[model samples]
Target: MVSLTSPAEAERRPYGPRHRWVVLAVGVGAQGSFAAMFSGIPVTGITMRADYHLSTGALGLVLSCLGLGVAASDIVWGLLTDRYGDRRVLLTGLTATGALLALMAAAVTPGDGAGVVLLAICLAIAGALGGSVNGASGRAIMTWFAEGERGLAMSIRQTAIPAGGAVGVALLPWLAQASGFRAVYAVPAALCLAAAAATWRWLHEPAPAATATASATASATASTTATASAGATAGAKEAAPDATAGASPDIRQKSPLRRWDVWRLALAGGLLTVPQFAVLSFTAIFLHDVKGEGAALASVTVLIAQIGGGAARIWTGRRTDRGGDRRTYLRGIGALAGIVMAAAAVLTDAPTPLTVAALALGGLLANSWHGVAYTEIAAMSGPARAGTALGLLGTALFAVGFLTPLLIPVVIAHASWTAVWAIAAAACLLAIPLAPAAIRAR
Candidate 1:
């Protein structure tokens, strides 16, 4: 009979170079999926006006519904990933979301209200499916990488969201220009399906330890590292140690809700999202309606925000990894951006170019905190509970997400776009003072 070995030996077995690519692909695919999920924002008003003849308020509800779905699924998917391995959950999700997007393309015809409802349902489905990508990818990276490099690696993975959004905003509009929204969904859908298939075929779990069968000739002392190395699979019988034993000294088990740091980060994250989402939800419309810019120009402006946001995430992530008070840095950025957003709100009627520039700068600074927040979450939760921590954080953020888009239209109807941005700025500012307390707790 064959003997089983320790888990410690198993982790030492390194993958081939090709396997590294598989890991990277999973990270990128996860980020890109989220990017595609949010692509609906820019085109929402245009679609509503063109098809179903809905008012801005109605379209806002639909947009908010999408966020509701994402928020609703965050906890479910996070727990699922923790129970099941990240690979299976992530692959299944990508496939299901892609199918829903394709279904959306087929269901919604131009100017069809029934189609609009169906499309909203499809969007909700896709958002739920997309929820798994972030937590799963974060956990996967934690599992695969050593402690030293996790920050840079995770930041790169996180970069996919903004990069994918940039791609969607930049490319989807052009695709719609040539064809239509129906055709537009095809691109992201196809990408998701292809990535899903690739993940399933290529991904492998951490290998099991080598086994050592007892033989009459074998001696315990003789079974040294060199001896085990010479004999094929001789070390399989050794049981693995806990992966976390040597990583950090401060490993503690705490309830997610009990952790003040988690709540602070989540709240701060949610507040920061207000201004970002406001701009994302309304930038295109503001450009089209207020600035009298064409669809192409509006698309460009959205793309700029996405690209800038994406790059900022990576840069801040690396910076946090290097050494700084992540909470302080994040809070400072949030506060500063809030001030800028408040200024932008007041200057909304300024020259078109100046207004766009202000929005872009505000978006960049506001979103720059993502990598820092994500990195801190992973650190705070430790590797084992990373999924849960990320899930909880996402749930809180998306809960706030559910309100921002719809709130924008209501604010715009009664007040002005300036009022909406001002309120969002205030929301960001609310988090500034709380951040210091959070850092102390951490």
Candidate 2:
């Protein structure tokens, strides 16, 4: 039950607790930029349709290619981050993502079939490279922040997704409108390259401190058994396996996928993400196509939704850090999401001001639990295996990203947008019960 702090922990840590703001800043930038680029395809769907004369189904395929690329390669990236360290993996991945995005921009040519295929290939490749940020930056922040404060830190870090979505909403539309689709891609590409440079300068590898990982339930079970001893109760209570779990190699030597807790958390995270993906990838299209809003109005609506979600993420993370059952918090979030989305589905009309408010609320509640869920995942696995764990989780999540759009159209074809949204709501509600199982297993 005894724990030892690494002497080089300070040196290996990317930032001390006081300087932890640095990790927060870098995490947001790296994640935000990657989120922007990765989610930009759907955001730019209208522009691409005009530029390439493509259909909705075709656009879905293009976006699916990118998601497929991320899902297929996330495990590799996660392993690399754990093996080579966050800083190196993040820098390399971010640099390559920017460069590949630029190449995709160049490959674009209006009305050229071959060029469309080429662009999809480039986007797929870029997505594979961009995925490194998830595992790397996630591990970095987890390494820097302690568990008591990590909820806020990770929530702030997770805000990058919506923050990046907001960035994409703001920049991609304006650039596409002003210059061309090419300019839209170039902007995020430039931001990513610059972010990589900043990351190189600021972030450090927490290799020494990183030895504290793998939150095994066996150790906690041992602690609980010892809790009966009066003198050892406090020590027993404090003894989570995170203090004793070995480094990345030790983690890698074991099978992450074999861990039932990891599988539970991963599945929960993946299922919870369906609603978020619906918000991120379909908001603009839904508003434009179903609500009869103009492109500008649709874009702004989606942008507002993303901004709201981002703010909610930070606030939710901070409160969760203070104390309480995080799984309960996530369950509440999922329930709220279900109610909101189901109401929207039944209303069948988005013309009123109230509909806008509901949409925004839906977006906020749909996305808010992300940070809390991540905190649970990190606690279950610790920093050493977080990347690999996240990778396994991300594959399930992004596969939804790839398939959801394609499936939405099919539902709309057979039923209505109401059906599609109701399906998303169902996914959210299902996540509620999944959380308790994940928690119990942990």
Candidate 3:
């Protein structure tokens, strides 16, 4: 089983005190590089539709392909991370993704139905490869950072999504406009390659002593807790073993596939993504078709949302690290996201700027909870099973990611954009109930 090392142990390693930071940077790079593809690809929705001669529904299918691929592969990658380690999985996945994107850039072109089909197939494959980033990078953070610091560390890692999205929205639309989709594909390929290099050079396992120390710490904590429960009433005593099960090294070492807390958080996380993906997948098109705004304004709005979301994630992480209930924060964030999305739905016919601001705010709030949710998942499952827990969460998230886009167009056809946002708001609200009530952080 994989074990988490404290920062102090990391500092004493031969690689230098700052080596963990290097690992964090590489994690950020790996995640951001893939984010550039999955999150950024939607930024080019307008261009893709025009170039590929696709209807709105067809465009959504293309977008959903990436999510579908990710959903399919995340669990596999997560299991692999537990077995093979972070560096190897990340290197293999990132390198292959880069090469695939390079080939896609050269071969994919505007032409017939075949072109759209081919592009979708390639994107699905890219998403599968890129899915490696989440579990591996997250596990690396869990391994290197202690409990007190992991919220912040993981939040910093989570920022890569919006940060990469910011870069993609800022650059890819213009690239698609100025050059073509070829350039857009090439850019992410380069990012993947660069991140792969960094991972190869820097990411490595913690010292064996650190792993042993962490295991001992976990066992000691469990023993203390079990001892404390010894004097409880009969009913409490009966529940003691189950309550302390998560703290046991034996339980910690087991796969997190069946953990109710893990599934609860995973499902909640998936539901929360509805609002986020709504903004991400359709904002540009909405601005263009409904608000009569150009791609530039749409891109700028998305860029602002991404930047704000990233900053919000960092702040939320730090705040939770200091003192706060992560589950409480998560539910609160979800509630606010639902409220904001509902307001956005109501304001769809309002003044253009007001509508834009509402959507942007909804996007920001929807995105801000990721770090907290992920931190809760890892903490509940323990560091040894962080990969499996994270992977399970990823599968849920990307499965929702897959479905949201494809369904959005159908909602638009039958109902309206307001209905779409309303449903998204409902999804956020629904997720609030699913968050685990309390978790004993590892």
Candidate 4:
């Protein structure tokens, strides 16, 4: 019931409530641009293999390089975001990523005599740069939004992955078929540049006094109330530390890198991503090669799944914002995703319509949990360390992302597509136990 915003500080504030929405928009653009590159590129996998004369494993390796780069650089970027702030990190990373993509378009072509190794190197570098987007954008959302609406805000930002992927899957394969892979790279390059320009034009930090007062009030309210609102409870738990150290300083003062709860959340998120990445990286291959579906249909299925996933994320975010328990919701999602993926694995040889339905459902369920998990992570670590916490989680997710593609081919070679889906289902089920339990109201 205590008010954090003083009348004087409210009068001094430059941005209005609408400005946070603008910041969210900019974050979506920055994140979606990179998502288009990583998630969308795989839609061109079949064409890429044929054009480059690549083996399936080789194609997997090339795709995995992007994940490798992102995983390697995410923590470092998080550290930099904490130190240097979001605007600088987003602008530098987006511009550099766009330029790298442009270079790839110009030089790393089938006709230009470039090999897979060169292509892999370019993708890795682009991924490393693009890795800056996640932590920086996420930290911005945590800073700008109050605890009550943070779930919805973070979920909206997280939807950019599927939204960008939808764009990529819809456009890239067609471009690859009509204009060649050069055009494929060129499109995302332009997007990155555009996103960079937008970031520069908008995306400023909130007033420090507003943030400080909110923290102090939330911390005080948390200590006094036996049963507070979800927003206040979360705020109290994650609020910034006071200047004077008490017998036990707030957990916010501890580095996210060293925290067990942060690690659990990161590991749970990484495990959950297995099925999502499986769908993202190989559903086209599964549908076309295994089910005898047309390439166009396969691409359309992926596009639909992405759009559906994006919608699910938004709904879940809003639902959680209305006082639903985030950790419980996350576990429920994991269970449903596992069930869906397991069904897909079991029905691998069913009729085409049924098979497609299973795969689509699996993708939808797998993609739905990201926003909730990310919101929980940021809330646990507090806004001050959000970048580092998010970066650690990104590293885990991308490391799995990198490994998923590379391992899928090996699984397919020895076993079958059923085995791959089954493993993915298992990973999803495993994640439920690892999701960090909700913090009790102290």
RMSD of each: 9.5, 6.8, 6.1, 5.8
Candidate 4 clashing pairs, residues 3+ apart or interchain: none
**Reference-based TM-score of each model:** 0.84, 0.84, 0.88, 0.90
Candidate 2 local Cα displacement, residue 294, angstroms: 1.3
Find the candidate with the highest TM-score and give its number: 4
Scored by CA lDDT, what does every candidate get? Answer: 0.68, 0.70, 0.83, 0.83
Which pairs of residues have clashing backbones in candidate 3? Answer: none
Order the candidates by TM-score, highest first: 4, 3, 2, 1
Once superposed on the true structure, which residue ranges of model 1 sit more than 4 Å away at CA?
1-21, 111-115, 207-251, 436-442
Give the per-residue lDDT digits (tens) of candidate 2, residues 126-211: 77888888878888877766654666788888889888977787778667767777787788899899889878777764443332
Greater TM-score among 1 and 4 belongs to 4
- The positional error of residue 165 in candidate 4, measured at the CA in angstroms, is 1.1
Candidate 4: stretches off by over 4 Å? 1-13, 209-248, 440-442
The candidate 2 region of ten consecutive residues with least summed lDDT is: 209-218
Give candidate 3's TM-score: 0.88
Tell me how candidate 3 scores on lDDT. Answer: 0.83
Candidate 3 Cα misplacement greater than 4 A, ranges: 1-13, 111-114, 209-246, 439-442
How many residue pairs of model 1 clash at the backbone? 17
